[model samples]
Target: MTTAKTFSATSVQASNAATPYFSQPIIITSLEQNIWQQLEQEIVRSLQRLHCSRLQDSTLLLLHKIITNLVKTMHRHAFQRAIEDDLNLDISDKDSIFTELLQNELSMHGDRNIRKFCRANNFQITLIFPEEKDTLIQIEYPTSCNNSAYLDNKLAKAIGFILVKQTHDPSSSYSRAKVVKNTAIQSFRPEQAGYSQLLTQTEELDKAQAIFSQLNHGIVVFSSVGDILAISPAILTLLKLETALPSVHTFTNIIPDHFYNDVLWGLALESQEGLFENYRTRIRLPHNNNLSILFNISGYRHSDTTIHTIWQVVSLDHKATDTLAEGSILNEARVHNITRNYIPQLVEEKAREVVRLGGHTLPNEECQLAILFCDIAGFTTYVENNEQEESVIHTLNLILGKITKAVKKHGGIIDKFMGDCVMALFKEPHKSVLAALEIHKHSYDFNSLRMRASRDLLLLRIGIHWGKVIIGNVGAAGRMDWTTIGDVVNTASRLEKNCYPGAILVSEELYAMVTHAHATDISFSQPFYLKLKGKRNEQMARYVQTEDEPFLHDTVAHSARQHLKTD
Candidate 1:
């Protein structure tokens, strides 16, 4: 039950006193003073990023005084970074800059920029002290107020100012202070050097960002350390987040604990091999609906040993499609080319079935089949330590070629290639087991050759199970994949994930079929119970492997006979 650790703003509590009054000033330690200074700098940076006009000298002084007073009070429990709703401030002076800013109601030119800034940003300031832990002293430029008469009352509470209203009286003696225009503000017509170029660049950047954000149907970018760089609006919406952005800064906070390991594994593969694509699975959301998503990762490496990963998450239920409208030549050509290019790569059985349907959609059908999954163990580590990219890729392809040939030789259909793993389907459970044994033998020979060559040994872990599954095309209109879907697929994958290197794990159902047939050449370990992920009950499975030279020839001949029967 491992979980992600959450990061929070640093805060310190007074160790000596349980309660201290504002009137009784406490000596501020250097460390506490440093914390306040850092918080002040953070506030300044936030405001600057928002393009707010610089605070006037009087306002700056007031802000410093407030922070200084808060630190001396020894009543501060925590300092929180600003969130969307409010910005807290403490005010004691009636003639302060905030009062002047709020008092401008009748004059058209009075504090208009400041008012726009506050309203646009939804800025509010709050302060909490020892006596009033629940009560907050707030200063905000209100957008609307219900009671005008209560606004005139200057009643002070335990801490300080609560809320100030805009005064419209013409005869009032409160003089409006001079507004400080933002220095960076400029007219549409540029007048300074590089101003036009800068504005053009800024506009282009803004448009690019807007396009990128909209394109993020479920895309996310994060650093190697799991710090989230960006997440798409679609993902935020899918997650049903209350805020416009994610509250947590790390990717692990948003990912389910059960799926974290899979994500980490993908990241490892991508980091070492540069890409991990088309990994499909169904994730149960908090709303209890299972959403089918295809995860793809692309890694960018920098010279300083930093890797940033971009994850493209496509929803299988609502996959993006390009629709052909009347008189749209580009759309028609694009769709035609994509379909022509993709159809040939599909499994032969599925491709022929699709063609036989004569442009009609194939309905999903359930049938019993044996699912097999296999992957190279220690592949990511070997790739990371080995700098020769070409050699790594060549070795990977060689191993996959061997596995693919074994699967085809045992009457199996290659379903898909998931980075280091390959999935296949077979009509017979015994054939699937035979395929797994063949793959183990191929890996053993490959490892022996690599060992003699002084190269890293790559071992394979395989899993097989026989169960009923639905086979059909899944995706949006104009874009779909012929694939198998059911619990059997997941269970087979889990078996592969849980198995040790150079071993083949099979579920009781599949193992029973093999043993009942009395396959004398095959050898299996003792039956074991596995508590697989996403399963309510433990599963019974056994490791199936091949024996030494005495049984090898007979097993290969048996596999050949099965393959010929299927042919």
Candidate 2:
């Protein structure tokens, strides 16, 4: 290619004969002519290197204008139609075009020329002209490519002009093209751009709804605006209503007498400083005219936007569940409460709550309780020795009175008194442990008196453990007794059998909660694993001291030392 200085500015657009084909004027300086010649050579080399067919359509139109403008500016010729037919043109896919450009030997030569010119003349050249149907030129090369340096200076200048033009009209054709390019790039990205999280959240919500639909009980969802958004079929049935109620029902229609306003609405106003439970409320039933149903209400605030309140309807009747055995010791009040009334009352109340709140409330599990057991050691021997019936009866009654009194002082319930043993219950381990200690103290006090009278004093053994036990009536319909049964009660009875005369044994489970007592020289025995008479499994047992000295294990001396040091 020749240098642009070979042509002057006045020589531009010497293509007047080709007027209709080229309406635009081609303005050029002598230096511009040199650049145009090099550009023309580059374009021709690109087509030859790619082995392309002639261009057509919009692309053909753009190519023609480029070639015509270059020829007019460089050769200063008023070219005819014959001149246009002499030039070569090419068309191809972008991939083939890129491959051809890379394979071109001319581009390698251009690299050498570029470096030399940059070193000697300090002349950096650039190409900034529009493609077909495009108003602004773009930087189509990757920055890290070896060939990109050739166009860097030109691209920088073109971009600067484009940015300045865009400031005036952001929606212009040039800006619109940039926007479209950005949008296409975002759309074609391998990963999701923005909506993936939303889609995942929607799917999770759908799964949760499906799970909720399968539940046996009713469900009601409330929004911040006091609107009842949804009610499940179980909830509708609970209220004795049709399942197909409209979705737009509010809380006012379901709950009676400002129920939502007092409960959730009032709760919402609070900043939620603490959690509370068993807040009670009553709901009016559909069929019952004389009585309103009761519910045990409790709620937790999930977040600022959601408050989940569970309302469990309380059974008006106190019926015993079916686990009760037949022909056992019975309590008439307990039996009447179980068979005649409780279960139906529970169902009705639940139905009322469902109708009022649009869902049934969850029930709370039975609370933690303590088990207390005391047995008279050598009871059979005492009865055997005191062969006289009156003497045996008198000794048994005396021992029972002393043990039962101590149990009552520590808030224990006397479940029953066997020939020589008395079984009781405590609500807390501290109370129960303390009571067991007191029972042993009283046993010693009574035995000492009997020692003064020259009689064999009664020896008592005590056991205690803490756990959950169902405290209700159990047995057949006509006969039932108020009692408790669970691992807690059984474990305590096992520990009682393991104890010796005047011994008080407790379970390790209870010891954890009553560690404070042991710290005060009230050492316990090393945990013993033993099988009970009736049970197949081995259970763990520990002996607690009612006195001020360590009475049990020598193996726990190291632990005792540590406890002493910590004290």
Candidate 3:
């Protein structure tokens, strides 16, 4: 009766070679002080107990190969580097030893002609010991082959397990292992024969944790109920707390009255559709007033039904934005290395800045980047005097979502949103102008759709300009931001404020770039010079004609013009 429990050596061979090897019931301590002795004894006993095949030497060789391979594999970790001081071993020789052990063990298995091929190359085993605190053993072999013996994941894992078990270090215990071929080396604690050195493991983990803690970004771990669980050092600094949120503290207690309804409560319902949803929002902190915060939220399932979450809270100060921009360049670099993607050439320079300064800093550049600013005409009065809260948010979302898609399609980057207004930019002038024109064209259709549905949609006005400016990341460590600065960005904002509802205005600087690309219907509506705030000179601005545009149907145009006149 070939029951599952009554397994033979042949069955063992098939099982051991499978992915995720290591099926024996042997305890780790069994090989603590003596790995080879323990492994040799176990294999002989297992073969005798099975008593199924006459292939005793083959079984014994397989067992030795697996154990030796594991030992060689585990000896090559960075965490184990400190252990070499005791054996006075060189890194290259250490790797060579493992390579030999893996090949030797596999050659003994005889599934391939590796043993005969290795002998033809005049390869021989040699035992060498490094002079130091602990004894080291290695089997040397020549490395000149295209053998299939060195390419098996299952065999590698099995050998790694054996090596780790034999060299037990309470402080340096490895939760993982790897297997090498032919060469094998094992080291143990000087005074304690069974226990390996574990001090390095503990220190590495502490270092990693310290690095995370030193980051200026706020980190918070939340339970299934959205209650704060663990808080990082940065979060504590933001909260002005030496400890976690107080016993009496709740979400509402610390959240601002203005943003609480719109952000916190708003996300809980929307996030069930997907995990790790990010929200760029504003929050009033205890000490920092009117601070912009980016709430990066992600969820993890704790049980079958319960889900826990983590929130990375970061400030949106201008300095922080700059740092973020610099970090983006580095992020782009990491992507480039892994995927061979072509990032903007600026990324390498940004990485160099990080390398020089020990962190990312802003860049200084002069380029003709276009800027667009916009607002919904008459939205404040409508919100303040007539519309419901839910309706206002829903209407704003619909309008913004459409505009956002247009900007993205045209390669425009959104800067910031001021209530109903949006600020967007483009490194390329023609694209920015076209994107703004599209936004103006779509506003009319959106208004019509709302009117037909018996909803009141607000009119939109936009302003755009293009000129040289400084673009880079700026801000403190962890609280950095990505944005532009200079008179050009400010001038664009001023032009936007001068616009009326249903109107699209473009400064001459931007219009010149797109004059060749757009159709003949595009012309000036009102030619006027507008006084701007910061600049000493009066800026000349002209309105683009919204009449008979292809994107604006006759009926919609009439309604928009009527709406514009009535206001």
Candidate 4:
């Protein structure tokens, strides 16, 4: 019979500032001592790839201490749980029971223990359990663990441990593991030779393919000569291809002639200087001149000769159609007239104004701008109940037309129009408030006319807020828009969404601005403090109305005159 090797339970001093191992000498029965020796032999054999001969005596002692403590602690926990469960486990099943318990505990706390040990020893270590196939419990000392490499290596070293070289800090005198080109453990049975390496290569390929299939952006791997080696599924979806391309395809075969040269230039520049350049271009699909895909291309050098080109779909626009239905109130023709023609002209004028003021960008200087959001209340229900599409379009346009006119008249710019809402920007808070009042008064008159005609009354809710905003071009290339992006816009939209119909809600900031400007004639209801959605604290707001009756009449008359002129 073979006699098990005996390990001394003497405590060892930590190599660094870590706590010393085992404060007290651990006492164990003869049977448990044999079990502990068996566990130690297994762990030592698993880590034999690290070359035990070159390790210092201190490192060997430390490894023994770690193994001894681990076995002892795991044995205690497993027995404790067994006692709690009232399990009468047999002596013959002890090895299997211990193996099961070790797997469970390692899955839960293996990485944590490795982290604590590495910090104490000032080294990096990765452990793998034979039972837990393709799993690694890794801890990186003095650095962040590379999860990707850990995952890949876990599949490679399915049955053994890994030890990384320690940090090259000059102050430390401890001997560290020497760096090796292939850190993967090579200790395995004769029958299992090369099995782990083959499995690792297969797993890596499968993982890469899985990732490419799930990504929203398209990836194209090209050789040094620009031959397409691989392409992701998203490329086919974006280009609207019915079938996958042949394996032997080139970049010029798929890329349009207009953008092929630009892509080539960008790829060459990136490959030469190792700099990533994002090129945005439009691709018109075959037989679809109106539909175009906007792509933002970037490159990643995989090697000295291979480049991975990434294509991200920024925007898909159909020039022949609009966001709304063809016969809706905000139809294709009207939307095109406003967005394509009017908004661009307004943006150009604003750009020119900035240039005249010796500024390179429009509205680059942060200044106070008032945002107003107005929308028709219960508009969705109205659309659902109304069957006459023509009548609905006519009525909806009338209401939106009046709101647009009021905004323009008050020195405001029509930012954008939603289905039943209009967002506007004003240089002055008072002007935005005035526009809100005029919109409310116009809605009142529209409701009066609808009541006489037995049509559903239209009610409007408006919100006004003033804050420092930076206006600039926002959107992907080939389709950019001048817009204001800040918390003020969100707050204004939220206020409009929450306010009662036929009411104009002004934020406390905008109210203060109006009062500071000495616009005392604007009447406001009692301030209401309420919590708005997405806001951390309660906010103060009030419903605003116009106290000047003559001002209201004059604006109404001017609006009627404008309507008559249009007729």
lDDT of each: 0.53, 0.49, 0.51, 0.58
lDDT of 2 by residue, 433-514 (tens): 7777777777778888889988776777787878766444356567655456767888888777666657777777888777
Off by over 4 Å in 1: 1-348, 357-359, 548-567
lDDT of 3 by residue, 482-566 (tens): 5667788888888776665677767877777667556454555434566666789877776776654544333333444454455
Q: Candidates 2 and 4: which is better by lDDT?
A: 4
- Listed in order, each prediction's TM-score against the native is 0.37, 0.34, 0.36, 0.37
Quality of model 2 by C-alpha lDDT: 0.49
Q: TM-score: which is higher, 3 or 4?
A: 4
- The alpha-carbon deviation from the true structure for residue 260 of candidate 4, after best TM-score superposition, in angstroms, is 28
Supply candidate 1's per-residue lDDT for 29: 20
Put down candidate 4 lDDT per residue, 34-94, tens digits, no spaces: 1232333433432443444233332333333333344344344334444445565443324
CA shift of 132, model 2, Å: 74
Off by over 4 Å in 3: 1-359, 473-478, 516-521, 547-567
Q: How close is candidate 1 to the true structure, as a TM-score?
A: 0.37
- True-structure lDDT of candidate 3: 0.51
lDDT of 1 by residue, 1-567 (tens): 112111223223332466632321111221112123223343343334334425322233333344333322212111111111245555332335534434443133332233233324332222222232222222221122112112111222211223333444456322111112223434333676766654588898998778766756355565555556666556555554543554433224646443334444443445555343333333334443444344444444444434445545544444331121222234456776877633423345544443432323444444578999999877889889775644877778898889989988988888888888898988778888888888888888888887998877787888898886767657887677778888999999998877766677789999887887788767776676777889999888876756643443344334423533453
